[model samples]
Target: MTVYKQLLSLPENFSFRINLDYLKSTEDGLFRTDQESITRFIVLDGNLFFIKIYVSNNNRLVIETEDVSQSYTKQFERQIMLYIRDWFDLDIHLEPFYTIAKQDEYLKMPISKFYGLRNIGIPDIFEAFVWAILGQQINLSFASTLKDRFIKNYGKRLIHNGEDYWLFPSPRLIASLSMDELFKIGMSRRKCEYIRGIARLIANNQISREKLVQLSDINLAVKQLTAIKGIGPWTANYVLLRCVRYPNAFPINDVGLHNALKLAGSLDRKPSIDEIKQIASAWEGYESYATFFLWRLVY
Candidate 1:
């Protein structure tokens, strides 16, 4: 195997510790991290590569690959850079968000406590969609368990140094599966159908990340995503926030969001949808960040 190394500069005020904390909370079996480095597998151009990323003393990211081939073409480099940028939300400047957050009573302390935290995102649209669907109506812990089982059952794996690195199952692979095959992994029938339905759409090229990005309008994109089976308002907004990187894509109906807000406000009851809307209005374009920080408080 050929070794490849690259260094990428991080944005000012980027907190590797906070981002690692968020990643650690996911309990995803597909990736692993230690105090020094994060390791995951990524598929590019039909090739699987294991990448290990660490923060250097100079405050830049050091990415090393376990592939032996000279695959670092211009396009490959660009893809990796974009993936890293999206994963860390390096493009978003949070100073303005901090300015607004400090003025708001509910968000002030949490924001200060979790300073430099970004909305750690899922860069793959298909992965984001399937994850959001799997999480519906279930507690996060169970959802994570389901995710682990699903990946182990369907995802491709690469073994290195006596460890396994898994790639998220592709749309083509899932689209070819039957309900029984999926159900064996503990997926409900409806969810099985939903995953297959969306997978088929993606495999057939009827929908794609490129197509959605061209839409530009968040509302229209959400509408189109919601039109697919198993994608509701919450899932659509979750995709927008995590995959599309839309700053204002807030899932107001999320139980975690409501519970976080309830705890933050010390309310006797969870706030109603109407109350959530009113309370969230203060954050405006930064609603996703506010929701993410609030989620950290409870989760």
Candidate 2:
């Protein structure tokens, strides 16, 4: 039972309070949230770690890690920190976003109401893909319910302090699963096959996060990801935005974005695609951040 601890200095313009509130806004079974702390398990380089993070007295992020029955190395510790940094989007500067948003009508409210908020992300590619697939054409509430059931049924877990902490199922495990088993979780047949196909690609080593990240163009990465059966434009853009950290990823046709825009702009009805495109044209390079802030309005 080895433990590792680290204190991270949060970059400027980070509001732990706002980010915590955003995490608390949803009841995803992925992570357990407390009044001031959040805990979840991450598998890095095939080693499992149960990690807990909270704000310290000095406003630094205090990270606590427990290797699941194995000794860990300093290299693994650095990986853990990188994972945490990406999870909270700590390294990116938000001032540029703030500056651009101050003059935009739709972005103004989201930025103000959720000031200091980062685009909290899923750094795990497989997990991000699964989440995007499950969320397709469904409300977030039902998607979360399906995720809880799927994880409990197939994923690895550990009991800590009388509570069960679950890791999202591995690609290999999902790849080995049958259609009937996945169907029992309430996902559509198309979604089931899509997830299995993605799992197979990942488990077979045909696709990887590193490969995508190394691509010279984000568009090429998007093209490759969208080549998968289940990953369309929306899912590809979503995974890229959340996991790969692409600044230009945007899901223009997303209903949530439309609704958030409607609410943000006080429109009598949801904005049309053309209207949204026109409005978002001003936010060319920062579409992902803009969409994230808008989504924060609802969930």
Best by lDDT: 2
For model 1, how does the per-residue alpha-carbon lDDT over 1-299 read when each residue is reduced to its tens digit? Answer: 76677899987777888788778877476789887788887777876667888899999998887652456666876777677787889889888888899898779867777887888888887888889989999888888888888888888877878988788888999999888999988878998899889889989999887787688778898899888878999999998888888888889899998888888888899999999988888898898899889989888
RMSD of each: 1.5, 1.4
RMSD of 2: 1.4
- The CA-based lDDT of model 1 is what? 0.84
The residue pairs in collision within model 1 are: 1-68, 2-67, 2-68
Segments in model 2 whose C-alpha atoms lie over 4 Å from true places = none
| CA-lDDT, candidates in order | 0.84, 0.88
